[model samples]
Target: MSTYLTILGYNSAIPTVNASPTAQFLDMEERAFLIDCGEGTQVQLRKAKVRFSKINHIFISHLHGDHCFGLPGLIASFRLLGRDTALNVYGPKGIKEMMETIFRLTETHKGFEVIYHELKSKSSEKIYEDSRIEVFTIPLDHRIYCNGYLFREKPKERHLNMKEISKYPEIQTCDYHHIKSGRDFELSDGYVLKNSILTTDPTDPISYAFCSDTRYWEEVIPLIENVDVLYHESTFLHDLKEMADHTGHTTALEAARIARKANVGKLILGHFSNRYSDLSVFTDEAREVFPNTFLPKALEAVKIG
Candidate 1:
C-alpha cells in the first residue's frame, strides 16, 4: 500500500497570511494519522479534501500553542459530526491533564471516547501499532518534553509470480496462498519445489519520520536513518543562528545537514518563520547540503513510495 503525506500547515510559531502553523497528515492505506494540530488544521484538512473521519489518531509533538492549539476545536467538530469511533491522542507529559482541564472548563464532552497516551521518557517509545503500521517516538531536543514520530510499514508477505502460478494451473487456490507465503508446494506427483524458485524479489518496507520544532541533535539521527521521507522543521535561515539556538529551533541549513548525514531519501522542509517573505532562501540553503530537498506547499500532498 502506498502512503501519502499532506502538508496541512507549514508556518512556524507565528502564523502568516499565506501560511499556518505546524501540522501534517499521513494517509496510509485507508487510515489517516495527524502529526500536529496547529490552528485551522481541520479547515486545512477539509481544503485538502482529506476525510476527517479517516483520522482516528492524533499525535502532538509538544505542548506548544502553535503545535496543539487546534486540537480541542478538531475534537469538538468530531462530536458535531456525530462520530462514534474511538480516538487516540499521543503527546508529551501533562497532555491529559491539560486536556482534562480545558474540556472541564469548557464543558465540552466529545461524542466519542478520547484516549490519551502521555509520553514522559526521552527515547524510542512504541506509541501505537496495528496490523499495517507501527508508530515509534524519537526523542527530540526541544524546550519542553517533545518527541517526533516514525511511521514504519509492516513487512508484507511474499507475492507469487503470476507467470509461475499460471504455469501451474492445476494448483489449488489454497496452495497459492502457501506459495505466496514462501512455502514449498508439494505437487500430487510428490515433486517437491521450492517457493523461492517461483517468487520474485521481496519488496522492502517504506518508512517516514516526522520531526519538527527541535534543535539540531545528531543523537536521534540513527533512529531516523534511511527513512523514505524525513520531514524536519526548518524554521529560520542561517542568519538567525543565535536565535535558533536560543529557541531550540533549527535553521534550513541545519535541517539539510541532518538529512544529509542521516542519508535519507527525501528531505521535506517546512515550519517556515514569518520573517522570510520568500521561501526560495530556505530551499536554496537546504539544497546546498541535501540535493533531494523539497519545500512542501501548504495543503500539498506528497506521496512516499
Candidate 2:
C-alpha cells in the first residue's frame, strides 16, 4: 500500500489562536502513527476524518507544551471511547512521569493499557520494527532532548512472471509462493531455473523523515538522505537566522539547504512563527535553494513518494 501523511497542526507556541501547534498523522504500510500531539490535536484528528482507534503508536518530539500537551487529553478520550487495546507511546525520558502524574492527580482509570517507551539516547537508534516496516530515531538538537522519526517500508517480494513460468510444465500453482520469494526451481529432469528468470523486481519502498524544532544541524543530513519526503521545522525567515540559532530553530532558507544537500524527493516547511502573516514568504525563500519546497497545509492528506 502507498504511504500517506496528514498534517494536523503546524504552528509555534504562545499564540495558538491563529493556528494549531505541531501535530501530524502518518499512515505507512497500513499502519497508523501519531507524531507530536499538540493542544486540540484530537479535534484536528476528527476534522481530518481519522479513526482514533487506528492510532496504536505515538511519537513525541520533546517535552515542550506545544509538542505534547494534547497527549494526556487524547489518552483520556481513548479511555472514554471504551478502547480495550494497548497503546504504545514513544517520547523523552520524563514523559512517563509527566503523563502518570496527570493521570494520578485526576484519578483517571481505563480498561485499556498504555505502554510508554521513554528514550534518552543521544545517537540514532532503531525504535520499532515489524515484517513490513521499521522505525528509527533521528537525534535532534533542541533546547531540551528531542528526536525525529524515520519511517520506512521494508523491501517487498519479487513478482512472478507468469509467461516465463508457463514454459516449465513441471511448475505447479503451489510452487508460486517459493518462486515469488526469490527461490530457484528444479525440474524432475534435474534442470534448474533461475529465480530471476521467473520473477521481476518489486516496487521500490517509500521512506519519510520528520525533523521538527531543531537547529541548523548538518549531522541529520546523512540519516535522512534520499528520503522520499521530509518535514523540517522552519520557524523563522533567513534574515532573522540569528534569532533562530539562539532559539535552536531553523530558518526557511536553512531548511531548504538541508533538503537540497540530503537530495530528498520533497521538502515540507512547517512550525511557522505566528509573526509571519503571509506564509508564501517562507516558500519564496526556501524555493530559491530547493525548488521542490512546499508549505504545510493543515489536515491535508499528502502522499509521500
Q: In order, what is each prediction's RMSD in angstroms? A: 1.4, 1.1
Q: Give lDDT tens digits, candidate 1, residues 1-305.
A: 67889898989888777888989999886678999999999989899998888888999999999999999999999999999999999998898898888889999988789999989987798888998789999999988889999999878778778777677766777777777777887777888777877777667778999997898899879999999999999888999989998999999999999999999999999888887888999989999989999888887778887
Point out the worst 10-residue segment of candidate 1 by lDDT. 168-177
Clashing pairs in 2: none
Q: How many backbone clashes does candidate 2 have?
A: 0
Top-scoring candidate (TM-score): 2
Q: Candidate 2: list runs displaced more than 4 Å.
A: 15-18
lDDT of candidate 2 over 1-305, digit per residue (tens): 88899999999985366579999999999999999999999999999999999999999999999999999999999999989999999999999999999999999986788899999999999999999999999999999999999999988889999999999889999999999888999999888999999999998889999997999999999999999999999999999999999999999999999999999999999999989989999999999999999999988899987
The parts of candidate 1 lying over 4 Å away from their true place are: none
TM-score result, candidate 2:
0.97
Count of backbone collisions in candidate 1: 0
Every candidate's lDDT: 0.88, 0.94
